[model samples]
Target: MIDKDRDTKKLQWNIGTGVHYTLNANWALQADWKYNYHRNTGARDRLWGTRLIYRFGEGNKYI
Candidate 1:
């Protein structure tokens, strides 16, 4: 069961950051992190992620 009023009125804070680096014209890398804290429930959450990107076709068209 879930309480709609409590869920909607809950207090929380979230911080997030990410970075992107171009390895080359067609390749790139990215990483991210996030932190969440819930004041009402005393809950904490953390998330970390990474990504690899690639572009097709000719040279760098997104100069």
Candidate 2:
């Protein structure tokens, strides 16, 4: 069955790590790296990706 206008999620391989550094009160910096892989049965079917992220937030929740 298929649903219209509904969000569907697919399975994919992903690995990532992140670190947060606080420069002072009420501010922070975050860095992250990720790898994603997609595979299929065909010989030419392959996908790979990397990602980075920086975020700022308040309080100790950023850690």
Candidate 3:
């Protein structure tokens, strides 16, 4: 279940950048950084995160 009113009237901002490189013929590595901002109920929050990804196949994926 979901609440529409609770989901609405909220403001958020997000920015992200990522890079990928092949470490070997069968593997690749990726890194990413993200920043997020949320405002609600007269309060504001800023969050950031970093992620590292490894792939077994030819293509790399990140989140």
Candidate 4:
């Protein structure tokens, strides 16, 4: 038995999406995806990530 004015109040939400491809001037490739929602009790989460970029000694000069 526990119910001492329980009202913490909780709400969470998140969404994200990204993609960038530029296989030139050096090398660049990235991909990301994320989605999360937690309302009341219905909890759900999903995340994805991928990245492979490299640039050294002046690579991309606003190209």
The lDDT of each candidate is 0.90, 0.53, 0.61, 0.87
Ordered from best to worst TM-score, the candidate numbers read 1, 3, 2, 4
Which 10 consecutive positions of candidate 2 have the poorest summed lDDT?
39-48
C-alpha RMSD by candidate, in order: 4.0, 8.0, 6.8, 7.5
Best by lDDT: 1
| Tens-digit lDDT string for candidate 4 (1-63) | 245445566788999999999888788999999999998889998999999999998889787
Reference-based TM-score, model 4? 0.36
Off by over 4 Å in 2: 1-11, 41-63
What tens digits encode model 3's per-residue C-alpha lDDT throughout 1-63?
Answer: 368777776787777777777765556566677676666654444444444545566644542
The TM-score of predicted model 2 comes to 0.46
What C-alpha root-mean-square deviation, in Å, does candidate 3 show against the real structure? 6.8
- Sequence-dependent TM-score of model 3: 0.51
Candidate 3, residue 17: how far the Cα is off, in Å: 0.4
Instruction: Point to the candidate with the largest TM-score.
Output: 1
- List, residue by residue over 3-63, the lDDT tens digit for candidate 2: 6433364445767777766755555567666666653322232344334333445545534
Error of 2 at 22 (Å): 1.0
TM per candidate comes to 0.74, 0.46, 0.51, 0.36
Task: Name the candidate, 1 or 4, with the larger TM-score value.
Answer: 1
lDDT of 2 at 20: 66
Error of 3 at 6 (Å): 11
Better of 1 and 4 by lDDT: 1
What CA RMSD would candidate 4 show? 7.5
